[model samples]
Target: MADDPRPAARRRRPLRAATIGTYALLTALALVYVFPFVVSLANSFKTDEDAANNPVSLIPQSFTTAAYQQLFQTDLPLWLGNTVVVTVLVTAGRVLFDSMAGYALSRLPFRGRNAVYAGLVAVMAVPGVVLLIPKFLVIKEFGMYDTYAGMVIPMLADAAGVFIMRNFFESVSPSIEEAAKIDGAGVFRRFWSVVLPMSRSALITLFILSFQASWNELPQMIISTQSPSLFTLTKGTAQLASGALSAGSQFPVKLAAATLMTIPVAVLFFVFQRRIMNTTAGGTKE
Candidate 1:
């Protein structure tokens, strides 16, 4: 090394350059992704004319809360309530149902278990847009159309959530369950008390994802219900964007709605983001 210090230095130089380059590229990408959100937030505080004229600007010509006030004057409260109800129901249902299905698939011995899992994977691979018509037909045929059940039931369990939970469950040691069984705990008791308590990280990950998906969901909401009373934030915001709520560009109002709609999901993600990454790594290792 003393004799060839130049060679080692040269080797590290390229790596250092590469690392710097990578960081620069990532920084640029992060800015690109965040720019629109920054503009939207800024424009939300702007008057409609300012927002329309300077949509890409991060600084408003003059700031105001008129857009938010206007939004509240509309059916925003009803939309917020509906969104909260549907999102809570959907999130709770997904956590319970997805975990149960995952546990069953991972631990229970049943005929065609592999086949069922294969079907689940297949379902995940299918594009959601392709299922829209079928989902609508099923909801209508079941007489759940325009009802809360139509909005919440079909989304209660998703293939991806089941897949995540099953993988996490498989990574868990069976000896824990075995010990519970030896203590005279039945299947349901072991699942609820033993297995579930240990699955906190995975459950939180599922909860965050389920909450975000249901909160932002649009296509399903569109197909599920037409009643204004059942309209969630997504539908209401879409209406606002389409000029159903106001005339002219209404950029401030639309962006204001978008900004508000993004807050909950953004907060949830930021709070639980670390756990999500850890769960993903854990799942990968298993």
Candidate 2:
């Protein structure tokens, strides 16, 4: 039997080797990916001296929550307020406007549709960094500078989100839309009640993506406002990098600020993560 099992043995040898190599590579990559966040968490609890002394330790010799305490007591609350305002306005506006525009581009019979889409693509191609100064200048010209409106409006209409939505709308069967029309449903009614409800998965995916993008956005904040009270978490965190918050080294406060900034997006990711995964899986299946 051993001599007769040569083909099976050869197959098993290659499979075993491939499996072992995959696990080894994945384990090494996981550690590499996780090490920085681990260090940040550990170092956040360390005193400046301890952080300096043991830069590489994951375990704190003495744990401290002072950084968090100080964070709550300082500009963190204000930054949190600003971030909430900007993110909510940006996400809501993007979802409503982007979807509407995308739907029109995909389904509605209208003139200049292709031109509009081409324009959006062109807008998307314009690198964001290049827009920093120009966006500021426009905000100033529009008298929106240093205002929440300035911060929220420029980012509300992202072309990428519109493109994502446009593709999704196009992917849906046209037969259902024709049926709705036959039932005497108006354009708005069909879209509002029928199509949108069917697009729950795509909408959720867009929501999660827009929330993450707007929440983590840093440069927009820097360019839009100068007042301390208007500063978002990203702006405040950038300030924390200057070492002005602490008498000497304030890594804890900075880390705590970053942690606080991370929480809302973290919560959002957790809540809607399955929808995101499902959307990706569905795309792969197609």
Candidate 3:
């Protein structure tokens, strides 16, 4: 019997239509998500009045870099430098401490391990806002207020990062670790030489998230430091947004700062996007 080409065509017609519709929907969502950044970039090139008057428009009547110049004139550079330092340190610390803690939880057998894991889950459930005063008091008690230690120490170990790494470590084959043990690799050596290297995807994902969170962190910086020299980009931008430096809205200047601050996060996301996608897909499959 001859195959029915007409019926196959009909079946493919609906599938193709659904695919097109899905792509159209995704493109629209992408545009919706992207329009604000586009508007911000356009407004950053416009004069104050131009930005205010044409807030949604992408074209500028008079393009200028005066906003950037003004930002550079202020302590924005210092704020950026401070933010870079804090983000780098916090990210590195989270990666190291969280990965180690996660490895311990997932691989090491100890008394009260389940209790510790439960406590971490509970801590993750707690709202960060609830910890503001407690964190502040601890920082003050330790004489860390308005200092880099206050800014960096509290963020070193994230509960979520530990949970993520632990789950990933559990998914890894236990046979590898058994072989390493037979070869006389100690715990730390086994983690560093075998387990950690295999967890690169998870690490990169953690790195991106930690970097982004610490980079855009505002509340912790607010509670931890008051000195202008210690101000991060988020704190400085908030001040700029509040019309502290200028009497008027000065949208261009504020947006310019925001745009600059966004660059590092954007770059990091793009660079690791492939690894992120693969990890997510692998997790979903598991």
lDDT of each: 0.91, 0.84, 0.91
The digit string of per-residue lDDT tens for model 3 on 1-286 reads 9887999999999999999999999999999999999999999999999998889989999989999998899898799899989999999999999999999999899999999999999999999999999999999999999999999999998999999998888887777777889999999998998888788889998999999999999999999999998999999999999878766889999999999999999999998898862443222212
The CA lDDT at 166 in model 3 is 89
lDDT-best of 2 and 3: 3
C-alpha TM-scores of all predictions? 0.92, 0.90, 0.95
lDDT of 1: 0.91
After superposition, candidate 2 runs with Cα above 4 Å error: 1-6, 277-286
Judged by TM-score relative to the true structure, which candidate is superior, 2 or 3? Answer: 3
Please tell me which predicted candidate would have the highest lDDT against the true structure. Answer: 3
**lDDT by residue for model 1 (1-286), tens:** 3596889999999999999999999999999999999988999999888888878888888979999999899899999999999999999999999999999999899999999999999999999999999999999999999999999999999999999999888887777778879989998898899888778889999999899999999999999999999899999999989888657899988999999999999999888877772453332222
Model 3 poorest ten-residue lDDT run: 277-286
Q: Which is superior by TM-score, 1 or 2?
A: 1
lDDT of 2 by residue, 149-268 (tens): 899999998999899888887777767777779989988887887777777788888899899998999999989999999999898889988765757677767776777777788788
